[model samples]
Target: MPISTYQVKSFAFVVREGSISGAARRLGVSQSAVSQHISNLEATMGAQVLIRGRDGVALTPVGQDLFQLADEYASLDQRIEERLRGHAALDRGHLTIIANAPQPALSLIARYADGYPNVSIDFTLFDWSSAMQRLQERRVDIAVITEPAASRELYIRPITQSRYVCYARRDDDFAQRPVVHLRDVADRTLILPEPGSLTQRVVSKALADHGVVPRRLVTMTSFPVMKEAILEGVGVGLFLSASSVSERSLCEVAVPELDQVFTTCAVVPKHKLGLRVIKSFLDVLADSRA
Candidate 1:
């Protein structure tokens, strides 16, 4: 009689997962059952495979060879089942996307939602620092980040360019100013984004370049909160141009002399591309902008 496929699968899973307990959890069986499966496979082959250590299992030379063979078999099985399943389901997957507050990334996600009603999306709003934190922790599956950060384990894809704009309340006295100079605020109060955000950095550098420091300042990260600060005459706001759009209450102030624009990119775990839905959404985002 041929060896059972389940036992061989169990054996392969243990080595890949690095322990009997992990394999058991993957297989939804007891840890002892996983160990028994490995033992049975070793007995059937009349050769030792896993070299058991105090803490975990390691593959021997023969075990490594068999593990590769089993991996190939599993890959083939997955492909066959997926291909046989035919049309992909439109609805029924969860997508978590993180972006700086009210940026173009939000527009992209909204466009996708309009087309695919069944697929659910969770949108997280953060300043740049917290967005990077969520990406590193895998709290968000997709991240729209500024300036395209690179990490050894992450894949970053640049999708678009953005820039900072000064915003003031539509009816405010400053709204009629043809162009506001950076030095104009030297004696006035200002509201800034959280310290670590890209907008905050831009505003800080601009002030330093002009050799004018603000006398009074308020720092907060939320887009809506910053809007309130500007409207209430707390100070001026230097924020991403894309975030201030679609609102009649705020007016954009552009300074061409500065010639500064920030880029927003998408990032995800490199190995997660193997999953179909993740790959498709990435394609859609790239296509949406193109």
Candidate 2:
């Protein structure tokens, strides 16, 4: 028996979309049809290619090897189809983008949209960990992340560099200070993002290293919420600089111990770089740097 291209493409879409239903929607087929294609693929290969879980499908070792080639084939097929369609190549497409912070990602997205107005974009903000997870899972087209881990599978373009800062109400005592050390916030309430977030990991390490413990530690869902909590007298909030909206009632105080600068980068899978949509967005990024 020979392997079918439809089966491979279906498997690729399943991995790309992270769910059977999503692949079905992308393929304009029924869920049962997608599952049948996957089952057929496994039978032909004599191995299980996917591990279906409640969250989504994960690639087995064999599936991982197959996906790399299938993804490239899919990209090539799309390119060929676009070429045959003439000027419609760059006129339409969809991109899924994830980011940890707003600045560079939102700005870059705006610029890309101007050049490719017909292209639809789905942009979402996530904490550092979640953003990177989505990128690793091959679920998103692009990721703008802070200090993204190096991987041969990904191509990273440095966007900007920034350090962490503490946010406090204008009337708070720390707000009037030019700079505060890690130990300075020890006796005050501390507001931070929830666990599993980069902010929490970095702050936690810093606190442990310096043996600084806050009087009360509070966790918020996001940077914007942390800012609001600060205004409502919840506690001092810590996060990367320029990550949230600036407010007249809030003051950004520099923290010397947490002054390590982190680079933000736009990352895409190496194999995805050849895709027209991905390549176009990178062109926008390149133009911005020039």
- State each model's C-alpha RMSD to the native: 8.9, 2.5
Write candidate 2's Cα lDDT for 1-290 as tens digits: 78887888899889988899988977789999999999999998999999999999989999988887888777677677667776344887878898876777888999999999988888888888888777777778899889998998999999878899988899999999999888988899999988868889999999999999999999987777788899999889888887765789999899989989998899998877877888899999999989
The TM-score of candidate 2 is: 0.87
**Which lDDT tens digits does candidate 1 get at residues 1-290?**
35787777787667645678877975679999888887888888888999999888777878877875674454345345545664276444556687876767777787777766676777767888888865654445688878746787578888777667668888866678877677766777878888778778777888887797888888986787898888777777777777745678778776554567677888886645555556667878877877
Q: Evaluated with lDDT, which candidate comes out highest? A: 2
Off by over 4 Å in 2: 87-89
For candidate 1, the TM-score is: 0.67
Task: Give me the displacement of residue 142 in model 2, in angstroms.
Answer: 1.2
TM-score of each: 0.67, 0.87
